[model samples]
Target: MALFRTSIRVFHSSTRKMTTSSVTRAPFLLSPNQVSELTNSGHTHSVSLLDSTWFMPNSPRNAKDEFLSKRIRGAQFLDLDEVASSHELGLKHMMPDSQTFARACEKLGISPSTHVIIYDSHGVFSSPRALFMFRSFGHENSSIIDGGLPRWVDEGHPLDTAAPILPEPGTYGLPNLKEGAIKNYDDIVANSQHDPATNGHVELVLDARPKGRYTGTDPEPRPGLSSGHIPHSYSLTFNLFLQKHKTKTGQEYSTFLPPSEIKAALDNAVGTAEANQIINGQRPVVTSCGSGMTAGVLWLGLQLLGVKQVGLYDESWTGYSMRPTSQIQKTS
Candidate 1:
């Protein structure tokens, strides 16, 4: 009953100004309240709220195990590591080709028409990657649930402990494979700014790894990999942008800080003048991370700021450092 009332309220408030593009593009960061209202308002048929939760291999908490224990009502579990076709390629969570991705989408009950809303068990982690992946495949109706599972629970939304109910498999075909959505090794090598002093490049590489890993002062989390970063890549630890906020119910959750603050931090990492010019997609931005996981976080951050040309290094450092011809640079 309460949800019904909430849905009615949302309808009343949003109906007046709702347009085709508004629904089509839908806000990238969805609030828990808005999600609940949509679910209860008979608006869930076309929506797919996925639990895109993934944990590091060594982490004690298992994403699938936890999703099985409890998750948002009408949500599906999408294991980032397992959903793609990267297993045969030896790359961790790298995207598969369009046909494979389309098949995986069918299995998940997602079509090109489905509106994808992703969240993660961790406050703000793997969901961005899933959302980006969807966009890469021409799904424009994709968005991320802000603050993710923690915020959803903190807001007192309903959860189902039972197994997720799967819809009949849906058919998906890539209509608009957004080129330059992902930057592969060859793309990186071609675009890399080897000598920053002499080369005047507009596109900049943003590495989302921690400072220690970025500088090679700390060993990589994955063994058998060198500890360094791509040449001329700027390091902006993904977690550094997450700000703590309290819910109405007094529970704390993580969210990206305000745009101004985020812009400041980004400017500090990249040159202030350069950062200013990167706005509204004017300059292309390439993001990377340890294993292409946290890179999505940074990618999403740039999108939130309305930077148009953001691209993810699909395999990130894991693939780069393994290449015999790749150049690894260390600050120290």
Candidate 2:
């Protein structure tokens, strides 16, 4: 049996309204201006601003060092690697157990009622993963800053270099894991065997890695891992969901493409018919990437397109490829 049942809805972004401390904003996303306004109004106590920056292992940038040097005023750093579960497979950013997650939240001064606004140093890169973590832990009162810290700086928002003050530990309790929010390796294997043409409820696995990696023409960044895709999975690079835009000061940054453009990209990736099936909830979606970080981008993109029946393969390709019995498809 699949870990996630067909009836489970992963995230309901539409029709869900969330209030950010003193300001009521749309659920799941907030603009930089709105975040600044909330902080300026002295409602920071009711909300937690988390800088959830991360980079690939090959990247020279250290997210924590960058955050320490300069970060949004009143923002606390949430290390994705540190706050995650110590996976037996050595997967990075695996969702921690409920007790562990609750403790991390408490240390960050996050109560059950506190609204979390997550952002990354890179615009819209890893913040969605952070948002997913919170939501998976049943913290639905969280949202991501629309364009992250780069956009904030592009808009002339000031950064604070001062050391962050430790937050008083909040009285947080163990949270229930959201049922069906994650898909495991067995689930993927089962999903792969289901023929979507015959099974309308079949879950679609969308790969968020680059096409080169998906086709097995390029080497995986991680050593010893085979480069290929999950059977029947569609390659939809995470960057397709984002677009580059120049700010007023001539600084260019990346942000989510508009809904129309995102939908078009989806159509291109999975074909119009399959995309429609996903959007209309006839076929559920489980997004996967090399290590599951970029997969959150696809998860968020589907939410933006109003696809409610979606989940993330938490261990993603990393876990899948490591399984000796796993089947990998390569086009090239």
Best by TM-score: 2
Off by over 4 Å in 2: 1-26, 246-252
Clashes of each: 1, 0
TM-score of 2: 0.90
TM-score, per-candidate, Cα-based: 0.89, 0.90
| Candidate 2 residue-wise lDDT, 85-147, digit = tens | 887788888878888889999999988868788999778889999988887777766888878
Q: Could you report the Cα RMSD, in angstroms, for every candidate shown?
A: 4.4, 6.2
Per-residue C-alpha lDDT of model 1 across residues 1-332, encoded as one tens digit per residue: 11122122112221334323323455667778878876776767778889999887668888888998999998888877776665434976887678878888898898776778899976788988998888777676777888999899887888999877887898987555588887888888877745443555645889999899999999887888898888878899997678877777666667877677778889889878778777845466899998889999888887777786788888899889988999888998
RMSD of 2: 6.2
Q: Which segments of candidate 1 are over 4 A away from where they belong?
A: 1-23, 87-89, 196-198, 245-253
